[model samples]
Target: MDISAPSLRAVFTAVKTEFNAGRSTYTPTYTRIATVVPSTTSSEDYAWLGEFSRLREWIGDRHINKMALHSYSIKNKKFEATEGIPSEYIEDDTFGVLMAKFQDMGYAAATHPDELTYACLASGWNTLCYDGQNFFDTEHDVGEGENEKLVSNMQDGALAPWYLLDTRRPLKPLIFQKRKDYQLSAKTDAGNSDHVFMADEYLYGVDARVNAGFGFWQQAFGSKAELTEANFNSAIEKMMGLKSDKGRPLGINPDLLVVGPTNRSKAKALIEAMQKEGGASNTNYQAVEVMVVPWLD
Candidate 1:
């Protein structure tokens, strides 16, 4: 959990080398996978408002509100509202829809073999801001198209990027107490709190899938603690099945899997076990190409 600066740098170096070596000019696409719990009360609405308010308070009201409005407008264009509420307004909120839109546009491309697609899971805290006025009126107003271009710049030759939200759903209770608990635990015993480093509202909403993706890629690529070709191959095979399990063939196979350190460890163990089994069975199989990255704290 206490990843030193040197360790962080080393990881980045490895990531950059792998990414640049496999870098392609192909435009990277992405897929958005998300989960949401429906809101059932005004308190729920207030909860979202409060969370958004907290973000605004941290940066400034003008910035947070504007960004929210702008994001809403962009998404609203695609999702027409039926009455006073926008049709896209699921009880959960618009974040899910925005992510879905990105996926539909192919932003979240797969990282499979043959296709040689690079895949990544991106997450961050409240990196956007909006005012009561037009949401587009801020220094952060990169148009949707421009946002895509910015993300493309980060692909570094991978096929697609998968954006994951690892935060509380809008309208959900803000568990500040849970965050306090983590902080207290971290201060007391480093070994006692594995969840101490877990993200909280203060860090902004990041998706759990981002963690999963990080774990998935590290194991698939053999970039973590254990380095082995067999493990990598097994990881890739499992990913292939996940990508298209229902007999619907996705024309491409992921060449790369992007994941974080925590999930990477889990994925590594899973892949190693699978490989051992396959070796025992004496089956010839190719490993998967994967990349592991840590996007945020």
Candidate 2:
């Protein structure tokens, strides 16, 4: 059945709203987070993240918003925080105290895992880093050369210094193509005093780098265009045509198509359209695996 434009849009919007409402149940909290592995043996050191813009944002916009060309060299240091279980509380309580202790530990276990995914996804949707000069109505030159670091003092280093456009090193939040081989552990203090004890926890983190640029592994900007077969095909072309840092054509066949909840039906239609076996065959057939991401919406 043919769908009218207005009706189709409405359907897309409604699907997104409903999917978002029940999305929590289907979200795998660790899918993206668990991809990062230990970049360093010690947590005190910093993990370097790299990013390279395949194309400047202005090129795609109708209005040219001329901005500095950025190549990133951001650093992600492992963060350390402590949460403890009192011996008295766990030891004295007879009912569910042990379980409660375990629950608290679970939260601690989840904290870093959740944070890694959050940070990576957020960076993709947001800017890499901001230097104070680029605050309001102006933008800063990310500068050239790896030696030239755009260091922004975010509250006297309350967080790792946000760096911008360092050619020496490409930076991105930690993203890995292979399974991260590592373990999470909590260590008890060597000795206890005053019946108060402490356990220090450490999470291994990797800096974000471009594992897959302008392709399935990397997030793509959809230009606020409504999802459709034609539009989706165009996006795939744009993605495949993306250039590398070396200014060479990145002949990438994107194996996955990630969409927001609003694009679910559109994605399905695009896939089905490609599967037809005749003159009706869509040029882009099974171009990529489609994944509906509610978090992206």
Candidate 3:
């Protein structure tokens, strides 16, 4: 495998094939729990998220809800992954390894969104949402004055966190803000590139601009306690009982449960089992789809 332009091009094609193949094999889980929001500039304002409205019977004039302009925004962040292969690797006929490397790179690139979304989710306990409250806090305002009731979306404890989500709605608990889709690029112009001339290497990389942020905290419940059936039931109860700012039922249906490697067995036994451990009829059987994600780990 001599370092001719044609040969280098052949290597690029092979590497790109592996990269695409890698991307094709991955099944990202973020789509299930995050809404994709396209961004045009460096950031997108979500200050309008201050309210969630519902349809009501018409009386007279239309009720207009003004955007609060709370300065809440999701800024796009640039991300990149790059690798350079020594010209000697192609000369040594080790392009197969490079193919695998690019494939893994593609896999990693595909998984990045999930990583950001879930990390944003996992930080719900502390990070603020559009309402100026932690996405999973216990002090979210449901109403004003005497009608106000402090609500919580999280249960704190000393263990790995698991999440219950209501994804039946169009908007999910998280937002994946993508400014630019991930793309693969190469700098194999050996005649013109200083990197190629000086380093005797060909560079390949993937880059994109994307970020993740919390959506409706009302549609999600996080627990750091043990992942038990009782706790699961409690989480479901909490989420289902959630009310809107106007004190209307949010109608949140917890349809998905997310867990990490440490809580896989617990999550499975709680939902996947046909019966409770006591031989009693399991009331929570197949209640919700359980997702096991390594990114959560």
| Top TM-score model | 3
Error of 2 at 26 (Å): 11
Most lDDT-accurate candidate: 3
TM-scores of all candidate predictions against the true structure: 0.20, 0.44, 0.94
Q: What overall lDDT, based on C-alpha atoms, would model 2 receive against the true structure?
A: 0.36
**Candidate 1: tens digits of C-alpha lDDT, residues 42-136:** 11111112112322245534652332222211010011111111212322333233333322222212222112111122321111112122111
TM-score of 3: 0.94
Ranking by lDDT: 3, 2, 1
Q: Sort by TM-score, best first.
A: 3, 2, 1
Off by over 4 Å in 1: 1-120, 124-249, 271-286
RMSD of each: 25.1, 18.7, 1.7
Residue 190 C-alpha lDDT in model 3: 82
